[model samples]
Target: MNTKRLSNQGGESQHQMTARFTNKVVLVTGGGSGIGRSTALAFAREGATVVAAGRREEPLAETVKLIEARGGQGSAIVADVTRGDDVVRLVETVVARHGGLHIAFNNAGVLGTPQRIGDVDEATWSEVIAINLTGVWLSMKHEIAHMSRNGGGAIINMASIFGVHKSAPMYGAYAATKAAVSALTRTAAREYIAQGIRINAVSPGPIEAPMSLRPGETEAQRAERYRETVPLGRIGLAEEVAAAVLWLASPESSFIVGHDLVIDGGVTI
Candidate 1:
């Protein structure tokens, strides 16, 4: 059991030691910022040669820089998760660069503008579904293909507590995609577990990430709202979410399969 904390932000990340993922090849999508960035750095700290992917190259580069600053090895790749060809190439590139992809965190996602189902625009709905639901599927498609052929691997997809246990009025579209992600994760886990591919999801709520803040809402306001809304009296940290991802990707969770771990600070309870 690896007990090393892998949080990558605030003041606590200065300490480092490699454990569960040493010499492993890990891939993180949406790794340009927030949970993705934190998770990528955490994996690197564990001795995994991480590949951070996002649509933007600049953020990806910065994530790599942070990993290097921590004496960890990582690289950045700009690839949109919504495109199948790009996903295929992303997996190929990781395998070609680091030998093989042993772990993958499909954390890329988008939250369209909040609107009632009757008032939401079609384009917004489509984009959210494309990036959130379809994107995860595409990533797993290529990732499982490579991992199954080479050896067993672990996957962690990003979902939301809203999608799994509750529903919000303006967040219907976003929640739908996340619910689909949870369903897809369970189905895929069953399909590929026999082949040594373990699949799971992390469904978080009101984390310290861009997606948690409402439009025009400041961090202070969001914090206060979390106090009132969440049973834990606070929002979750991106590093906290990252730690969950790292655990799911590690052998520590070898017996856990098809489980959508909720890290929502009791929001569902």
Candidate 2:
């Protein structure tokens, strides 16, 4: 088992973490940065042999480097989730290279430039749907195929509070896709649970990421906004969300399927 001390991400530090995923293989899409990267590291810390997948190779490699530094096994695989061929090849490659994919975090998504439903351009809407919604579906389509036949696995998709809990004006494109993702996750969960696959989602609010900031909003400004609006008095951390992701993927959550776990610091309440 690989053990490591995880640093605090805008919250208390974990002095030591247990190896809950020893001998397991985890595949994390969008594992290049923010919540994705944090979740990748969190899985590695718990002893999963992690495969960090993204379109960009450099950032994915950097994530693997961090995992290695903590004495965990990890590698980077470049693939665009929107491409069916890429998604298929990615799942095959992980299984070919890593033995088996025990868990998957389908976290690839984009926050399309904020626009009202009536004002959104075709390109903007298409891009958001392609990446945020289509990408997840494609990833899951292949993942479920493999897991269902080969002793099943847990799958976690990324959703957001804006769609699942509260929708803001001028963010129609993103909200629509996320709400759709939640719907897909719930439907697919029931469809595949009989086959041993557990599907779930995490809907996060204002985490400490670039996507959380509004246009022309500074970090301090965003912080202040959340401080005033969120009941927790601040935005959530990437690690905080990552922790939830890991739990959803862990054995502890064996019975939690079709559930959208919200981690928004009470803003959605």
Candidate 3:
């Protein structure tokens, strides 16, 4: 009986150990800047070969450079998440190059034109949903298909705190899309858990990123506003959010599925 118990414990120990993603293949969408860029770099540092996709060529190149500088392997693919053809090709190229995909971060999104619900035009709403919601679905569709072929993998969707709560006025379209992301994350997790695929989300509050601030907002004004609003008394940095993403991707979170890891500096508290 003691020998049998020891064998069982050893099996559990093997599952719990965390070399995690060594030699795994990871793909991150919107990986050119902000949280996406940071996530890609973090994955590379952890010994995963990365495929970073984005709309712009320059930022993708820069991310690839950073990964290579650290003696890690990564490639940049120029693709817009909103375009179905681009997304399909992006997944295909990654699988062809790496033989299999072990992790996918569907982090591409857009805030869209801020306006009141009644004032939001059809074009504006469509644009926001297309990129923020529909694009994520497309990425999942392809990634799941690929992962299914090779046993399974993990997927992390980038949501926002607004996904769980209401935003101020004029953020109708953006907030709605994020809320949809949360629902989709849970749905996918349930659909694929039995197949060795894990799906989860990361909802960040107001991280310091180029896209978070408005075009004409002064630095001081933005800083003062965030200081007053956030419970932590300061805004979060992109690297902090990336850390959460890395945790979800690693085996340390193997038992955690369908959960939204909220990183808001205690603002929601």
- Which residues of candidate 3, in runs, are more than 4 Å off? 1-20
Tell me, by TM-score, which candidate is best: 1
Candidate 1 vs. true structure, TM-score: 0.95
Model 1 steric clash total: 0
lDDT (CA) per prediction:
0.89, 0.89, 0.84
Number of backbone collisions per candidate, in order? 0, 0, 0
What TM-score, over all chains together, does every model reach? 0.95, 0.94, 0.90
User: Would you give me the overall lDDT of model 3?
Assistant: 0.84
lDDT of 1 at 259: 95
Which ten residues in a row are the worst by lDDT in model 3?
Answer: 1-10
| Model 1 lDDT tens row, 184-214 | 9999999999999999999988798888888
Please, what are the lDDT tens digits per residue for candidate 3 over residues 1-269? 23234222123332232334678999999998888887887788777899999889999999899778766789999988888898899999998998889999999998877678999899989999999999999999999998887899999998898887546467888888888999999999999998899999999998777767887987566767888988888777776787788888887898999998889978788
- On TM-score, who's better, 1 or 3? 1
